[model samples]
Every structure is written in structure tokens, then in C-alpha cells.
Target: MTDKAKKKREPIFSPEDRSNLRWLWLGYLKKRAPWLGAVLLMILIQGLVYQQFLSMTESGLRVIFESGEVGQLVLVCLGVFFLFAVRGLMSYLVPLVTVRLSNEAIFEMRRDLIGHLMSLDLAYFERTKSGEIIHRLVTQTQQLGVFFGLATAGAVRDAVTVVIVSGYLIWKNPILFTTAIVVLPFIIWVMNFVSDRVKQAQGQAERALADYMNGIEETVNGMRTVKIASQEQVEAGRLMKGTGAIRDLMKRVQTTQALVMPSIDLSSAFVYVLVIGGGGYMVLSPDFDVDGAGIITFLLGMVMVFDPARLLAQYFGALQSNLVLLDRVRSLYDEQPSINDAPDAVEDFDTGGDIVLDDVTFSYSEDQPLFEGLDMTFRGGQVSAIVGATGSGKTTILSLLSRLYDVKGGQITIGGQPIETLKVGSLRGAFSVVAQDIVIFNNSIWENIRYVNPEATEEDVWRAAEDAEIADLIRRRGDAPVGPKGAQLSGGQKQRIAIARAFLRDAPILLLDEATSALDQATEERIKAALGRLTKGKTTIVVAHRLSSVADADRIFVLEAGQLVEQGRHDELLETAGLYSQLYQAQKKGYDGR
Candidate 1:
């Protein structure tokens, strides 16, 4: 194929293909032990019924030769009828039970996958796209249903049937039965070959699909902005490119999977033709005197065995893909959380909200440092400010206190103990943070406020909302929907709801990253007053490029190029006439029209 043609083809195998389908099968079966027993009972009943049919055939022949009464023949026919009826009823019941069981298992598995994703540390989310994580949690797990139900477990039942039928065929005609059995291993080898390719292609396709889905999510989420900015065509072009790649990958995967079935069918047909032609010639000529009727029954048994074996064979490819899916799942399952509770981590920690960072250095990447040699502290029950230009590590300092990332060097202690040694939950429980870009869910205003503390009563929620000055806004909603991210509300209103949530959390430590940056001057003044009162008994750390916002802080630290260059009370820093002084003077000059 040409490069263009090859590119158009979908991938066949995925990393999940290498996953152990046997485990997926065994685990699911173990979960559905009751249903499996029912299916087994049905199988046993059917086998006995089939055996009775054979017996009836022989008995009827003898009766005809002996000229038995017509009543006896009628009785024999009724027995056969009853057996078939019972078998059909059991067959129906088995599937109904197994299907229900499998569906419930899938639901449980999906729920666990979602919980697993949520348990992952924030760093994993930072490195992974929202869509990719969602795809694994939703789409990939959805694909496992067929594998869990009809493919894996169903494969087991059909395998048992094939063995029983093969045994019958061998007893009736050893020569033909041996030949069919001998051909199975070769057919399985070929199926396994195709299965390997399917797994590899599917993995690539899954990744491509994740990329496409991510693009789609971004576009949908930003559709309004894209339209207003006249970037629709640009976005559409990018989506088209992504969609095209996904299409190509899927095509290759489907083509490889499709070929396996037909190839196996052709192999089976060739074997059948050879068996019939060779068997006839041998029986007609010399030593072999195989009875024609017995041969017919044996052939019928072979047909029954072949269908299930063929089904099992075709499943090799699906099993491969399912394996890959599970591996991806297990990868997530096996991950160690970046942040976890320490053995002796603090509980109900009462530190007067003092935070101390001593010679801390940190980096997201090995070679690129976000901050270096940062020493800072916020006094208990005091408002401290960090001011810096963009990328000056202001936010990085807040993150350090939150313990979002551990320092690469030096120690950060809370209440005279290394932060790492303290229980992570206990340490984090002490801080309430509101970032520059606030997020609100599509929920009732009351629910959003209470999100910080689910156990918080309605009275507590209302009190927080009132303090944050959003009580009236929420009351006006009167149980109406608040659109996603609070799009239905004004920017200032949305910020207040976020504040309400943080207020309700009632942590001893507060980190506000430009919390009031979006509000008008009048609203900013009101919120500032409220926040000032709120932080009176808490350690408050504020980051603001707006010098006026930080002027009232007990102490202000100026950061530049990942280093703290200046620190002192606001007026004292101004007297020093350094970086902080320069910023204050510039803002003052801008205000005075000098």
C-alpha cells in the first residue's frame, strides 16, 4: 500500500490487548458464581436431553424391527418432546440470569473505575487531559461488557459444549474425530496471530480517539468564545485533522479484526471438504467399513462442536483487545497516590495558622525550576501578601503551603513538624483556597455553598452565603438551575459563591490568589471588608499584582525570577525604595496622573 493508503488504515492492536483476558474472565465469572452455576445446570440438563435423543433413536429402530404397539411409539415421541421443551426453557432462563448478572458487574466495575480516577493525585490530572481520563473511565470500560458477558464467560460455556460434543463424535467415528481435533491447534495458532495484531492496532486507535475527544471537548466548552473571536474555521480545521487521524486508526483496527473471522471460516471449509472427500474414498475402497448412518451422526456432532469452537476461536482477537483495555485500567489501579496520609499525620491541628518555608526549592520538571531557595513565613493571625509579575512564583508559594507539590530541597514545617510528616489530610484540612480562575458547578447555589462541608446544615450554608454577600442572589434563584460554572450569574456574583464555599470550609489558613481581581471597586471594597474580618483570626496569604489590594497586609513579600527579593511591612518596604517600593510608587503615580 501507498503511504496515503496506509495512513488511511486503522490500527489493529492496543496496549490493552496484552492485558490478561483470562483474569477479566475469571474475575467476572467469580463475581457471577450464581449465574454460572445456573448456566452449568442448564448445560448438564441439555447434555442429558441430547443423550436421551440418541437413546430414543436406537430404541425406535428396535421397536420398528420388533413391530411394537403404536401406543409405545407415541409414548417415546412424547418423552422426546418433553426433553426438548425442558432444554429450551432452561436455555432461556440461563441467558436471562447471566445477562442481568453481567450488567450489574459492569456497573460496579465502571463505578470503581470512576472512584479510582478521582482518587488520583492532582498532579496526574495536571499531566492528563480531562477527556483522556474520562474516556478511560467511561468509553474503554463500556467496551468490556461484551468481553465480560458473551465473550469471556460465554466462551467458557461454549468450550465445555465443544468438548462434550467432540467426545461424542470421537466415540462414533475415531478417524474423522481425530482429524478435526488435530486441525484445531493450527486454527488457534492463526487466530492468535491475528489477535496480536488486533491488540496493537486497538491501542493506537484508543490514543487517537482520546486525542480527538479532547479536541471535541475543548471546542464544545469554548464554542461561544470561538464564535465571537472568529476562530471557528481555525478550530474546525484542527478538529477535522484530529478526526481524520482517529478515522484512520479505527479503520486499520476494524480491517484487521474483520479479516480474522473470514480467514478462519475458509480454513474450516477446506478442512470439511478434505474430510468428506477423503473419508468417502477410504470407506468405499478397502479396510475401513464405517457405517454410513454412524458417519452421519458423527458428522452432525462435528458440526455442533465446530460452531462453538469457531466462536471461541474468533474471540481470540476480542480477548486480545480486552486484555489491553484491562492493562490500561490496571495501570491506573496500580498507581501510588502522590499525596497520602502520613502515619502520624496531625489531626485537629491547631497552629494559629503559622506557615514557615525554609530554603525551599521546587520543580515540575527536572531541569526547569519553578522556585529556588525560597524562605518565607506568614505569622499567626496576620495577613501576609505576595506581590510579583507573572511567572514570578507567587502562585508557586501558595501551592507550597497547600502542599500541592513537595519541595525539591529544604523543609516546610507547620506547627514545628515537617509538612511531609504530618498527615496529608490533616495538613490540607487547615487551608481554604480560592484561585484566580474560580470554578462553580451546575448546581443549586445552596448546594455549591455546602459543597465544602457536605455535613453542613442549611442554616450553616445560608450563614456563609450571607457573609459572602450572595444570600440575596441565591434566594432570587428560588430553586432554579444555575448554569455550568455559574455562567448564569455575573462574574462578581460567581466569585462571591466561591468565597461562600471557602468561608463555609472555615479552614484556619486562607490562600487567596487575586480573589477580588474581577470585581468592581464598590464590590471589591465590600468583599475586602468582609475578608478582612474573616481573616482576623486566621493566617491569610494573598497574591495580587494590584499593589493597592496588598497595602493593608501586615507584611508583604516581593518575588522576582523565582526568588523572594524583598519583605517587610508595606510602609517599611516603601521606605527601603527597592522592588516593592518601585511597584508602590508606580501604582501611586498611575493613580495620581503624575
Candidate 2:
């Protein structure tokens, strides 16, 4: 396809996208409509009082010039003071209400976003960077709250003020008002043009910020690797480049804003000059019978009109910037999780039975198939081992059995029922997986074990820890901090803590994925003993790298390039001299040479 064709095919905003934004905005307003309505009423009252101040000024001047009674002059002065007081009070209260309402809306949005993120499938996290998600949830959501709460309200209030003041000016002196506003249309056109530029600049700035955040996130996450490789200078240079790009984009947005404010001021200044010059001629010339008070009132009203006009221009620029943030927030809300429960999905499942994969076909992508029409059965209440080299589909089998990813073709059954029909939470709860890549939180050992079962008693925790052969270590630590990612513990200690968690879970099905691949010989032997007891009654599937670990299993399945080529017990497979026998012999030779 040509570049032009591809560009045309790309969608900027579909009908559905527009609908999502409308729905999001309506939802935000619905939650705080009462507070917003009160704010609007206050702003309206303030605008009316502001107009009263202009009239009072005219009346007070007329009273003094005509040498009216002292009482009448005092009354006019008091009325003007009262109007100013009310306007000042309303200005303060409106902002106070707006800020509170905006904070509440932001809190609700954050809570919902977190809940939505939790509902997404595992594959979403696998493909997306954590920093990007964090940026959307934290920075972007905050901007939306501020825009909706403060900027939207301020713009509306400014617009109302401009309309009221302009109406009064036009009512008092139509010819002068019309002459002053002749250049308004051109000023509006310029502002609209600048608004588009601001929006474009804001979009670029947000993208650059995301990139800068990603650079910082990657550096912190891989700090150990960077330090060991002596690449601090390299990482620093990369981050500086990202920061520079963000700074440049932000400067463009600020430059646009600076230009907009001056243009608005210059436009309003021209209108002010015209009104002042014309109103002066009428009051001073002997040809026209214009009173001093009347001419002074018209000039004051014209100044009032320009005040709101300038405010509205500023609000328009701020609104344009916020519109970009709103679009980003709407996009996040529109994302739908790829995996969700079926409409008629079962809510309860019985986990006791064989796990059977019938002619399963699967792959991460279409171009690179990982498994093709494979079949296998893991019998209940038995230890079955899947031994193969790296990338031989061992971990993939375990993932499929757990239904983390559904098969591209065929079906998986547990306890004589199709796994797809089972409830997702209950199906996953059936197994306790202990993998070599253990994840330990920075918490107490006791708390880590109890994470599997929050209601587990202290005695129960101790028993599980003892079974995993880590009770002594826990007792010695006695609730010492585990540090970040269990930095306080050794490799074997971390694995044992994971084992204790699985034992505490007491699930009916178990999966061990290279559970001892990185441990020393003595530690592996100790963990092996605990595993034997743990798998005695449960249906266990072990993915082993070393053939020696699964030599005593009831049966062994050998996989090669996503295909299962051999299955039988230790002696039976050796006699057949197939792939299993070849792998066993190679490992045996290596062990003897060592």
C-alpha cells in the first residue's frame, strides 16, 4: 500500500471513540451536579452585582455633581460598597466549592481505574510496560480532575461575566458599543487558531513525558545490572536526552500561551481606545447634550466588558490544554479486557480429577506455532514429570493447564468438565505453582507464607514452614525486614519460602516449574524431600530440567520442539532408547565428568 493510503486508513477518532468521550464527561458531571449548579448560580449573582457597581458609580457621581442632599449621597456610596462586598464573597466561595468537588471526582476516578486494571487479563500486562500504565493512572488522571473541577468552572463563570457586562453596555449606548466591538470577530479567529496549536503542542508534550518516565522506570528497575556492567554514564546520557525532548515540547506549549495572552490584551486595548475617544467627544462638545455622569458611566461599563473578555480569552487557552488531557483519560476508560467470564459461565467447580488436553493446538502468534495438535493426560493423585530441554514447551503446558491462555484449537477438561466452562477464579485456585523464579515481597516470613491463606493460624503457618524445611530460618529472623524483593534472603531461602506458601495453600493440583534449577546440590536434595511429601496425595505436574530429579516419577513425557515424542516410566523409556533415553544418557555423562 502507498503511504498516503495507509495514512488515510488510520483512524483519528471513530464514532465509538466520540461516544466514549461523551459518556465519560456525562458520568463525571452526574456525580457532582449539585455542587456545580450551586457554583454557577453564585457566579451569575456575582456578575449581576458587578454590573450594579458600575451603575452605582454613575449614580454617585451624578448625585455629587448636582449637589444632592447628604443623605442621598451617603445612600449611593453605601450601595456601591455593598455590591463590592457581595461580589468579593461570591468569588471566594465559588472557587472553594469547585476545588472540593474536583478532588472528590478525582478520587472516584482513581478507584475505578485501579479496579479496571485488576480485571484485565495477564496477557495485557505481559505486552505493556509498567511505566506507561503508571503514567496514565497517576499523572493523566490528576490532570483530568483539575481540568474538570477548576478550569471548566472558571471558563463558564468568565463567559457569563462577559455576556452580562456586554449586554449592559449595549443597552446604555448602542452606537458606542457596536463601534468598540468591530474588531472582536478577528480577535476570536486568532484565538481559535492559537487554540489548535496549543492542543497539538500539548499532545507532543504528553508523549515526551511518557518516554521520560519510561527511561527513569527502566533505569531504577535494572539498577543492579547497570551498576555491575559499569554503564552509569550510558544510562545517564539516555535519560538526559529524553528529559531534553520533554523540556523542548513544553516550551512550545508555553510559547503559544504567551502569544495568545498578548494578542487578547492588544485586541481589548483597541476597543477601549475607541470607546474612550468617542465618549469624550460627546461629553465635551457643545453640539451634543451629553451629561458628565452619563459619559463617565459608559466608559466604566466598557472597561468592565473588557475585563471579562480578557478572562475568557485566558480560559479558552487553558481549556484547550485540558482538552488534550481529557482525551487521554477517555481512551483509558474505553479499553476493554480481552479475557472476561462467559455470559453463562459456571461459578463453582470441583477440582478433583484428571487434567486432560485433547489434540490441543496453540501458539503465541500465528507465524510461529508453539504447539500443534498435541495430546496428554495428567492422572489424578499421581506425580507426573515433563522433562525436556529449554524452550521445549514444558512451562507452556503448565500455563495452558492453568488456563492463563486458552488453546487456539481443542479443549481442556478437569474433573470431566470443560475447563473453559469453569469459573476463572475457581479454576486458577485449584493449583499451587512453585517456580524457580520466586517472587518474595518485602515483608515478614510469616506474612509471606500466610499470603496464600490469609486466615491461616499461627500454628498452621509454623507447620507449613516446617514442612518446607524453613521453620528454623523463620524463627531466627523473627520478623526482620525482608528488604525489597527479599534481598535479605539467599536464593535457597527464597525458594523455600515459596514452597511454604504452596504447602499452606493446600490446593488439590500442583505445578513445579524448574523448582530447583538454581539451587546447590545440598539445597536441592532438601527441597526434593519436601516435594515428595507435598505431592503424595495431590495430582502434581513437574517441569524438570535435570532428568535425575524426575527419575522416580510414575511416568515421564519427553517433548521436543512443541511435540511430545516419548512417555513411560524411567526403565521403560530407557529400554525403548528414544528421545528420553538420549537425554538421560547425555545428562548422566555430564554428571560423571563433573
What digit string (tens of lDDT, one per residue) describes model 2 on residues 312-399? 7777777666667767766765667755667777866656688888989999889999988999998888889998878889999998
lDDT of each: 0.77, 0.83
Predicted structure with the largest TM-score when compared to the true one: 2
Query: Candidate 2: where is the Cα deviation over 4 Å?
Result: 1-21, 68-77, 286-296, 472-481, 585-594
Query: Residue-wise lDDT of candidate 1 within 3-103, one digit each (tens)?
Result: 86575333344334324445555655576777678777777777666656655654555565576778878877888899899878876776777677778
Q: What clash pairs does model 2 have?
A: none
In terms of lDDT, model 2 sits at 0.83
Q: Which ten-residue region of model 1 has the weakest summed lDDT? A: 9-18
